[model samples]
Target: NLLHEPVTIASVLSVPTVKENLEYVIHSSASDRLKIDGIGFIGARKVHLYFDPPLVKEVAYEDMSAYPLTENQIILRRRHGYTWRELLGPLKVIGVDTGAGAVKVNGEDGVVVAQVMANINVALSTANTQLANNNKSHSAPAPGASVPAGVGGAGSDFLNDLAEKKKTV
Candidate 1:
């Protein structure tokens, strides 16, 4: 069964806006071939798939069919009529391989995901450090320090209530 090991499908898309894009990793064991005609989010209307990479096949939403060819491979078909430049990024030579002197196209989803996660981790760490510093800087006042009037002083009503509750406990 394919359940014994899971396969990964990685892809990259160039959209008009990054806010509309969703990043996800799905795990499924169903053998039935499934097709995705559109993708939508809650409160957002579904958008038609305009173009897919590599195969660039044009298929109607009604007739589109997709299934995993192997454990790791699935065919990609584009929505009809979208320009190649709109689906993929602008056709510019990004790099040249000096060793083989050949051009190669590779998907960057894995690298993009890794970089995003690293950025999130760094942000979380920075926020936690700032919170800890704030907490340390605003510690309780010294025993003889003057607490303002109506504040929680030694004879404050709040402290008296707590003392009364502690006696009953």
Candidate 2:
């Protein structure tokens, strides 16, 4: 589920990661695989997120119609909460040759490529502004495993505010 927000940092925690052998996870049904600690995106692109403590638990059948994973991939899942800084430790577009600036091919100026990257950086740096906070309520109707550790840092503050907002009559 594309939680009105993105989850980062939690993957870097000291907890060990659990990996899924592709041989075991591939399935004819899309939703069925989602039950097994899978991370999904639009168009049924399924990715395997690291399970905390390096353990893969057998999950019950869930209405994972929400997440449609296409190809199988792996990523470190969030194990703990995070701060604004940690959420965006250091954003960089890899493969950029700093010495030569943007990359170009076959006698083409890299103006367009550079511009696109600049815009992406802007969107990321001010992500809160660029993306709408569709988080209408404190309770995330998201279908999946609950965060291993409760939110902390700035995220904790925001979640607390949302909880308060939810409590207000």
Tell me, by lDDT, which candidate is best. 1
Using all chains and alpha carbons, the TM-scores for the candidates as numbered come to 0.17, 0.16
In model 1, which regions exceed 4 Å deviation? 1-69, 72-103, 106-115, 119-121, 135-169
Candidate 2 clashes between residue pairs 3 or more apart in a chain or in different chains: 44-68, 44-69, 44-70, 45-69, 45-70, 46-69, 46-70
Residue 40, model 1, lDDT? 18
Of candidate 1, the 10-residue stretch with the lowest lDDT total is 109-118
| Tens-digit per-residue lDDT, 58-106, candidate 2 | 2322223333334232222212221111222121111211122333221
lDDT of each: 0.29, 0.28
lDDT of 2 at 95: 20
